[model samples]
Target: MTAQAVIQVFILVLILAGGILAVWLRDLLAAVIALAGASLLVSLEFYILQAPDVAIAEAGIGAALTTAIYVIALRRTRRKEKE
Candidate 1:
């Protein structure tokens, strides 16, 4: 396989790992961080695929904006108190 192909595969594997970690983590903040990492990797993959516009959108919206929103939401949530 070509170098580019190998790199793409590696990135894909990392993305999958991040996704799994996001799902498996008990901490909400950690899960958000893992998801953000996967989003960034996806943006990088788009850039490597020659889609710069999509990559930029994914980085800005998927990685940055979405992560910020999730973090803010998580911060505002309160745990239920035992009666």
Candidate 2:
């Protein structure tokens, strides 16, 4: 395969790993961080795919804005899952 395709596949693997980590973590803040990381990776993937506008939007909204909102909400609440 091409180098670009290989990079895309690597990014996809990282994105999936981040998603899995986010879901597997018991701490809410950690989960949010993982989600943001996944979002950033997705934005990078979009950029590599030749969609700069969409990449910017994803980075801004998905990685930054949403993460900020989640952090604010997490701050207002608790950081760990209650059992």
**How accurate locally, in lDDT, is each candidate?**
0.92, 0.97
lDDT of 1: 0.92
Model 2, 21-81: lDDT tens per residue? 9999999999999999999999999999999999999999999999999999999899998
Q: Which parts of model 2 are misplaced by more than 4 Å?
A: none
Worst 10 residues of 1 by lDDT: 74-83
| TM-score of each model, in listed order | 0.91, 0.96
Candidate 2: give the clashing pairs.
none
For every model shown, the clashing-pair count is 0, 0
Candidate 1 on 1-83: residue-level lDDT in tens?
99999999999999999999998877788889999999999999999999999999999999999999988888788422223
Candidate 1 Cα errors over 4 Å, as ranges: 78-83
User: RMSD, each candidate, Å?
Assistant: 3.2, 0.7
Model 1, residue 46: distance off in Å is 0.3
